[model samples]
Target: MPVSLTIIPELNLVHIIYSGQVTPKELFEETQACYQRPEYKPGMAEVSDFFQVTSFEIGYDEVHEFTSRSKSTHGGVDIGTDICLVGSTKVSEPAILMYEGMIAAKEIPIRLHVLPGYPEALAVLNLPEDSLKYFPEGCHTERHLL
Candidate 1:
């Protein structure tokens, strides 16, 4: 799989890394699975890394679909949190922007930040640059799929 999710309960953070080419289905599945995990708390900050991603097989329709699914599954509650999107190259920027736009349009109350790299993500979250050292080593899996 090209996508993985890592949840760091200690930091109240979740890191999602997308590599190669990613599809909406894979992303949705991993995200839904993350929600089911004991470590996943509402309003946890997220770092979504697309640095290794070559492309995203997503579009307006997919964004709409995912947004709907997310709202329904999460019960339309305020899951308000900070989300940092990293490494948005030309190939993946559109998808990232579309999702951010959708979230705004729906009044989701999330604070979304689009940055060039993880260092910026850390800074935005007020975490130390070396904080990544706390992430579980080899925690990448489709299920805790980082």
Candidate 2:
């Protein structure tokens, strides 16, 4: 699979790693699958790492529609979620913008951040630096070590 999801119910966080080429359908389906998981809850935080994604074919409409339709079975429409996106590439900017625009329209508590990588994301999310261990090597900076 191009996208993998790891839900940490203890911290109310979700970790996502996406690689290879991803399609809009696949992305939506993967997210829906995660939302259906037992650990998913309202106001859960998410760190979506797209650092490994090589390429993708998506447009604003697709992203907007997908996000607008997100209503987790357990987490109702008003539920909030904090999202951090990891990646800094020319190709990633559009995705970030689309997400921001769509999410803003929802007026829910979903907050989004774009970080260079996992190290910065941890700080932004206020997670213990040691939590970086959950990610693979190179996901964190030496300063992220604690």
| TM-score of structure candidate 2 | 0.84
Q: In candidate 1, how many Å is residue 92 off?
A: 0.6
Worst 10 residues of 2 by lDDT: 70-79
Off by over 4 Å in 1: 72-79, 136-146
**Root-mean-square deviation per candidate:** 5.4, 2.5
Model 2 scores what on Cα lDDT? Answer: 0.74
lDDT of 2 at 104: 74
Error of 1 at 89 (Å): 0.6
Tens-digit lDDT string for candidate 1 (20-90):
98998898899989989988887788888887788799999999988776556544447467889877899
Task: Give one digit per residue, the lDDT tens place, for model 2 in 1-146.
Answer: 88888887656788888888878888889888887787787567888888788876778888776777653332363656668998857766777787787777766457688887776778888988777767656566555344
